[model samples]
Target: MTYLRGLARSAQLLGLAVLVFCAFLVTVLMLAAGGMVFGLLWVRPLTAYCRALFGRWLGRDLSVSYRPEPGPPQPDEEGFYRHDSQLYHGPRFPAYFQRVQWAADDPATHRDMAWQLWFPLVVLLVVPIGLPVAPLAVRAVAAWSAWMWRPRPGAKERRRRTDAVLLAWAQCAALLLSAAVQVALLAVTLACFLLGFGLGIVFLIPTGITHYRWLANLRRQVSGWGGGERIERPYQPMVRPQLRGDGLYRVRNSLYKTETWADFNARWVWVWHDPATWRDLLWLGADPFVTGVLAGVPVVAAVYGAFGLVLPWIWTQAFGADWDTWYGAVAGNRLAGLVAGVLLVAVGFWLPPKVLPPVSRWSALLLRPTAKEQLRRRVERLTQTRADAVDAQAAEVRRIERDLHDGAQARLISVGLTLGAIERLMDTDPEAARRLVAQARETSQTALSELRDLVRGILPPVLSERGLPDAVRALALDTSAEVTVHGRLAGRLAAPVESAAYFAVSELLANAVRHGGAEHVTVDIRHRDALLRITVTDDGEGGADPSRGTGLRGIERRLGTFDGTLALHSPAGGPTVATLELPCALSSPKTSTS
Candidate 1:
């Protein structure tokens, strides 16, 4: 019976191979004939069939792990459905496009295409032999199918290492290119200075100084890419030329009727007088030699060791070809050459991870802002945050005023009018007077409720009384998503700090539920080393950008006022984490309800 089953399995495998080949040809032809949508549609069913066959052969259930299809679009307050910021009257087109994008972006779709192309070829090669070899062929094909169809455990780590090596090579190429660019820019700088000082053409000076600023800036950015300290930009903020009341723009003692010349002159003076410009020029002149040696050593050693030494040694030993090239032998000995070549190759691989960090630090020596620049930058930031705080306060006041006018205040006025009516009716009609009194009582209750709600909006009662930990728990209770809070503070934070943190957490929770489509969230709050740290994490489709949303920027400004910082790590398909840190001492422990 076992022998008969093997025979049957062999026949089935051969037949399945032929069938898959035919499907593969059809899919290809459909794709070639301008039917990509149809081709993609054809792939899923084919993958399902193959998965079932493979699973039957392997004796386990195979599963598909495609991303979940997006649900139907919900209409906004204006009764319009939104997809990627584009509003539509109906959901049909948006749904269709979204589905198309979903299919295109899915990794499973590509995996299916790969299986369709590769599986049949493997089966045909293995199963074409006689029955004696058929069982072995079946085993081979099953293993191949499992590897191709299932996710590999080490794939992510391997991919990361591959990416790192590729990035290192790319950085090497960029360094060499930048060295060449530096030499060229040094010539341009000299020409600009010569023209401005020697020939009296002042405009050329700013043009040349500003031109190389981008290269220096790019270096500053990439310096931090791979385990390196980030170098902040050292240049001062440019001041715009201000117009005077006398219908002229002023730059120092000089004034011009039109704004254009004054602006140009200001830029010229700004670039000329700033010490950073000279520093940048000095860096440019020095970088070509310093960075060139740092970047070129590894690449040159690897290339020379592998091609120049190792390959020639192999050729001479294997083929007995007495090639008399100076590069092939080290000091007239092939054995010595091979050992030296292996050592050089080892050095090449080992050097980049060690050297790149030092190179970045070297760049930071000149590129980082000086003490004066740091102080100035701090002052500017404080000024901006103060302005934002003032504006926010003004807006909050307006909101309170509007709510009172529209809600509680209006209700109170109606109650007063009703009471006056009741007094007038008491003597003439007793029944109508009693009804008016009941109406006025209901109106007063509603007005009181509105007043409480408005106050709560200003500062939540839980936050003010219980402190941050309990306040966060109260917040979690209010949100629709499941939230888990961890960690404990020994005591309470300052009132203002607590308020800022509570509101920030509230906003994050709201965003996670409404925008992120998250179902679960975690909030961790702990204080250590005189700093209070809070982290909000959500398992959501995370692509949060501060530039795209005002909520994040508002949180930043609020935190900045207390000398705090907010850091966000949100990848495309991920669990988003937003961390908030504030430097403050905690008071004595508060009595806990928990």
Candidate 2:
């Protein structure tokens, strides 16, 4: 079933990839040739935009697998919000309609899509743009689709409805007269430019600078409250309360709550509207066209020419060297050259025509600060999700502990008392006594298993019995990866610290085998001074965020509780290396057979 499901998923991805390729082709034809209908604009490859907006919703579901709870996320305090001039937080949209609010209701940061902002300017500057209405109509469709007819209400549905009506009127008027607005703005910029750089500076510099200053002030106002401080008067529980006014936290509290975001956005959006400060996303598609040709033309040339030749093989390898002797000699020389040449041709020659331009365009579209800010916000969401998951795990540990004491441990105590009573009666009644002894034996066995499992849950005794070295050796033997243990332990560590370090390495190795698909794993334990370090390196798929799974995160929490540390460095392609360090008392400076 897993194999069949895998094949099906692969086919689905392949189908989507083909569709995306076709859409890009369609986008090219419609934009270049004035032939396609306006509704066809969804073919412009809107994946990136859609991905950002929906990533959090997807991530929220994703977190549950990492022990995520169906509850609140963290940073649930004031500093996370925005503050006003007087440090009051702006109003925040409620959770249910947050995405909708972001789209239609976020007064501070909604800029129409880039092409929507650009084509009118193009029509004004040049007349050659065919089907100018295509771009405008596309924007109208997108805007409508985003907020139209959806069952849910946004943060402020009434405001959005009014705004939509107003925008509809503005858009129609703008469509009729955008050429005029473009020309007017051009005239103003030119009139200013006709004067010295001073006129341009006067028009542009302050526009961006003022907004930057205001945002800086807002960030400072909110963050300053993070340090614990109070207004002078202190309070006792049932007595008078403490009151000191730093004004920072009071403002942060207001911002962290409902009011903070509205105030912050009011300032932040001012930065976007600042003519000098605002990023012109129209540049996203534009600069790529120019720079892409400059960069891509050369690559195109290489793909066709020297890059082809450098693979160091010829025609037979391209076709193949016959099935049995695929690696056999060609022209009395090994076909390594021929095989490499074919791969280069496939990667370079066939792929570039399809790959380069859109990648450039997508990259260009993502160049602005707001896009970056959105990505930053996405990461923050995932991080907070992880934090909430960790909290849940901590709660689960407590529950498990309570369960053992109330259930298994209580049962064991009763069995022990009953066994004692049975022994007292054993001599009086022989057959009944035999049955009681058998019952006691079974209960004892069960009690022993329960105790062992509980202790394993707490800390595996392998950690102390053989220290880090033997514990890791045992873990390596347990995994499918070609795991090798190297180096020596200086000696014993603080028992708790040793246990935490050993478990951390054990979990990391387990992750490498179970999830990483690692074929080669190296575990190196070294002690220097009072620090005991274990490094687990694997040749596998890299991107294992410690916050993404319970294995890594559980290790992290355990280490934290033990005054130990864990770190990972994994990049794409392969090769993940995780390092753990714990302070321990060494029996000697160093010891090794080597």
Candidate 3:
């Protein structure tokens, strides 16, 4: 039964292997259609499919987050399209040039290309080499053990000796069959390489690109099976103008990235020579070998038992011979052989299923990334986070400038105009002058209100006067929704971080009241690991999308400048939690004012 199950599992893997092969071919063809400069456009979805497959089948997940592709240019509410030139410091180029330029400038694209180049070989080697060993070994072991304790001297002594010799030969045949399968695997590997490289050299890049799309998919499977951490390179490609001074800045920018070099090294050197690769090779060999040992014994026994049962009947029918002569004369009892064969076949079907988990885990162990790669990935993330912080700060500055110019400044100008009117009317008619003075006073008050709001938007006076903890508590008191503030810092946070935190909370509370329909909100704050953690929870309509609204997006941008992260958890029905983390130190007790 175990052996039968093992064979069934093997059958499933064989089917998957076929799919892998076909996917590889399709990927190559897709790449060839173009330079596959847009290959990632298709490749990412395929990668996701493979990620899902690995997670479901092998318990491995390709946990990768890809940046969204830029969509078509959108017009503002006023029906004007703001060109990227306004945002970017570099001189603008044609839209087509920018698209191609950005695509070429991406490090991930190059990584994709590298992946495409090597994937076919990886799939060709890994699927056949890694998948088949266990079941075959199970068959071999089954053959040896099936005759280990047979009915002694049941027939003539001579017949017994002949049966013993035939059984030995059957056992040898099973072992030889296992060896043949492995040899065949090697032969196929060599043939694939020879055929692929020899015939497809001219089309290598395209072929590789396509193959890589699938190969990455295969790796995802391996990764899931391993249940180990995945190392992702964390660099966003610089999309600065690709043509500076009429030179190819796109190529230059791509070359300049550390991510590009990491990818290049991985493709050309580390992929081949890395210890992780060797470990994968070891898994490729070891998994089948172990599983084969567990399952082979029963499978081999069944094949021989089935053969023994069927051969006699066929021979007797063909020759019109007696049952005893045709069936019993050659080996052992005909009925017994038939029964054994049927039972063995059942075992073969059952045994293979049992080995799947262990085999998957073994595969995973070999496939996980090494420590060095993990550290490198961490550094990459830190670098990207730092860059985001700088960009967010610059954007915040611009936003503040724009607000001051358009809102408070405009209001002050209106106030000045009203004052001038009052001055002109003063002597012409005293009663009219009084009315003008009242209008001017009202205009001045409105201007003052606008200025106060603008100033508060920049940095609330409460945050500076009362310290962060009190400011937040005061914020909760002012909101229409019932709000609670939990946790406290021993000392005050740095002014910038405190201000960022204050606004972030304010925006969230506003959102909860305005859009969330939230009746109650909770703000939980903590100081740990030289970092400030704030969690804002509200009983509200649950769906909160970072991409949908300007308010939340603005909060995110503000927090990002302080190297703060926001993780929003909002389900569709009700309740939302926004967790924000920022690295910072508390001011000393002497300096702290609560």
The prediction achieving the highest lDDT against the true structure is 1
lDDT for model 3: 0.60
- Clashing residue pairs in all predictions, respectively, total 0, 14, 43
Q: Can you give the TM-score per candidate against the true fold?
A: 0.63, 0.34, 0.44
> Which prediction has the highest TM-score against the true structure?
1
Tens-digit per-residue lDDT, 433-456, candidate 2: 778778878887887788787777
Instruction: Give me the overall lDDT of model 1.
Output: 0.84
Residue-level error in angstroms, candidate 3, position 552: 4.5
Q: After superposition, which runs of candidate 2 have C-alpha atoms over 4 Å from their true positions?
A: 1-400, 406-408, 420-429, 460-462, 477-482, 491-497, 513-520, 527-533, 537-548, 558-594
**What is the C-alpha lDDT profile of model 1 across 315-417, one tens digit per residue?**
9999999865578888889998999889887777667766687779878888889889999988988898888889888998999999999999999999999
Model 1 stretches astray by more than 4 angstroms: 1-162, 165-169, 194-203, 239-249, 255-264, 311-342, 412-449, 526-533, 567-577, 588-594
Candidate 2: deviation at residue 577, Å? 4.5
Error of 2 at 296 (Å): 19
The models' CA-based lDDT, in order, is 0.84, 0.51, 0.60
Model 2: which ten-residue window has the lowest total lDDT?
231-240
Q: Model 3 off-target regions past 4 Å?
A: 1-391, 549-557
